[model samples]
Target: PTSVSSRVYVTIAAALVAQLHAAVATLKPFVWQWDSNDGAPAWLENAVRPAPAGAHNTPIGLLRRDPRTLSILWEDGHRDDFDVRDLRLACHCALCVEEMSGRKLRDPQTVRADVSPRQIVSVGNYAIGFDWNDGHNSGIHSFNDLRAMGERAAAQSVENV
Candidate 1:
C-alpha cells in the first residue's frame, strides 16, 4: 500500500535500528556504573596503575614440574617457583575472595598438598588461568600478582637467613 520511496525509507530505518541494537550489545561489557557517593566510575575504583620502567611482569616461559609445581621465568631474569597448593591458596578470583570486602572465602587448609592443575592456560596477555584437579577453574592469576609472590618469597628467604 505504501509508495516505493516510503518502503525504501522504512527498510533503511529498520536497518539503522538493528545496527544501533548491535552496537549497544557489543559495548554493554564496557559500560561502567557511575558512583554518586564517590563521584567516579565504578571501574575507576580498581584501576590498575602502569608498572614502573625497568619493572617487568611478563613471564618468558612457564614450566610445570612433576607432582604439582610450576616454574615461571620472567623477562627480568627472575624465576618464580610455585607449588600447586600455594597457587590454589593465592587465587584472587571473586569466587575465592569477596569482591566488595576482599575477604577470603576459600580456606587454605582445605586445599590439599597434592592438589595439581589439570590444565593451565593464558587468560590473555595479562593473566594465566588454571583448571585444578580438584575441579576449580574460576581464578585468573595476573602476571603482576605472580611476580609479587615471587618477590615476597625472596624477601622471606632473606629474612630467614
Candidate 2:
C-alpha cells in the first residue's frame, strides 16, 4: 500500500546509502593529480599542483577532485575520493537549491577554473566546506562538480583555446 511518491523516496534513500558506503570504502590519504578537460586547460590544471601540507595553518591543503575517479587528493599526500553521484544528490547550497526562487542551478558545469578554492575546512563528517578563490565557496560542490565541469568542457573549451 505504498504510495508512488513513497516508493520513489525509498528508492532514492537506498541509492544514497549505497553511495555513502561506496565513498567510505574508497577513502584514503595521498597526493592527487587530475587531468583537466576542455573547460580547464592542461597548463592551468598542471599549474594547480597541491600546496604544501599545513599550508593554511588550518590543517588545510589542496583539494583536487579527479573527474574520472571522483578521488580527492591533498597536498600532504592524503587522498579520498567520494562517489560523485552521491555528492550531487547532496549538493547543499543556496545557489544549488535556490531557496529564494525555488529554482536549482542546473548547470553545475558552469564552475570555472577561477572557482579554485582558496581554502578548505572539514565540515562535519558529511562534507568538506570550501573558501573559493573566486569567493564562491557558498556552493560546496562534491564529486558531481568535477563531472559537470568535465561534461561542460566542450562549451567551456573556448576558454582554454
Candidate 3:
C-alpha cells in the first residue's frame, strides 16, 4: 500500500510539473527575427565587433539563442559576451517552475553545467523559443528582453564611465 501511495504521489508530481511547463510555453511570442547586414549570424558579428576601431558603437549584430551561446557585434567593431548558462537560468517557461508550486524557477548555480545549447525553435511575431540541449524545451526569449538587457548593461557602463 505504501509503495502504491508513493507511486501515486510521483505521478501527481509529474503531472503538476507538465502543467507548469505548458503554462510557461503559452507566454512565448512568435516571429522573432534579426537583420544582420548581409545575413550573417549574430554571434559572428559579436565576436568580431570589439576588435574594430572608430566605428559606430551601436550593435550592428544581435544574437538570440534557445540553447546556444548568443553574441552581439557592435558596428564600431566590438563584441558583447553572453553566457548560455545564464540565459537558461532565466527561462520564463512554466516547466521551469518548482514542482510542488507553480512558481517560477531558475537554474541553480550548481546545475549551470547542465544548461544546454539551444537551437532556434520557432520564430514568433516578436519572440523565439530555443530548444535546449539539456532537454529543456521551454523558455522563449523575446527581442524586447534582449534589448532591455542590453540597455540595462549600457546604463551600467555609463555609470562606470
Candidate 4:
C-alpha cells in the first residue's frame, strides 16, 4: 500500500512539473527581456529603429498658422511656411486620394482660397494631423514630408527669381 501511494505521489508531481513546463512554453512568446538603461524591451530594440536624420528634429519652438499660411519653426532653426490653400490641396489621405491607385479623389478646385485648419495635432512625434475648416481631417502630414515640401517650394522660388 505504501509503494502504491508513493507511485501515485510521483505521478502527481510529474503531472505538475509537466503543466509548469507547458505554461512557461506557452508564455515564451510573450516574455520580453527588459533593458534597464532606456527602459525599452530587448525585443523592441530591433523593432523600433532610430528615426531618419532630420526626422527627429521636429518643430521645437512654435507651430503657428494665420488665415493665409501655416508655419513651422523646426528645431534646427529652419522655418517652413506653407500656404493654407496649397497645404489643404496637398493632403494625401485616403478620403482625398485613392489609396491603391494614388489618384486624387477630392477636387483641388473645390477647395476655397480661404481654407484654413480648424485644428492641428501632433501624431506620435513624427507627424502632424490637421482638421481643415472644410471638415477634412483624415490626413497625417509627416514632419519629413512637410520639410521636403517647404524645401521644394523654396527651390521653386529661387528658380523663379
Per-candidate TM equals 0.65, 0.31, 0.46, 0.63
Reference-based lDDT, residue 48, model 2: 31
The TM-score, computed over Cα atoms with residue i paired to residue i, of candidate 1 is: 0.65
Query: Each candidate's lDDT (Cα)?
Result: 0.66, 0.43, 0.54, 0.63
Instruction: List the candidate 1 regions with Cα displacement exceeding 4 Å.
Output: 1-55
List the lowest-lDDT window of 10 residues for candidate 2. 38-47
Candidate 4 overall lDDT versus native = 0.63
Off by over 4 Å in 2: 1-70, 73-91, 100-102, 105-111, 141-161
lDDT of 2 by residue, 98-142 (tens): 787867664666545333434444443234554544445575654
Best by TM-score: 1
Question: What C-alpha lDDT does candidate 1 achieve relative to the native structure?
Answer: 0.66
RMSD of each: 15.7, 17.9, 21.6, 15.8
The local lDDT score (0 to 100) that residue 103 gets in candidate 4 is 96
Candidate number that wins on TM-score, 3 or 4: 4
Q: Indicate which candidate wins on lDDT.
A: 1
| CA lDDT, candidate 4, residue 120 | 62
Model 1 CA lDDT for position 61: 59
Worst 10 residues of 3 by lDDT: 24-33
Model 3 C-alpha lDDT per residue in residues 13-84, reported as the tens digit of each score: 999988754331121222323222233233334233233332333344555543345675544354455666
* TM-score, cand. 4 vs. native: 0.63
Q: Per-residue lDDT for 1-161 in model 4, tens only?
A: 36998999999999998875433110011111111112211111111223346443455433344457666666445677888778889899888899999999988779987787666655665676777778888898877788889999999999999
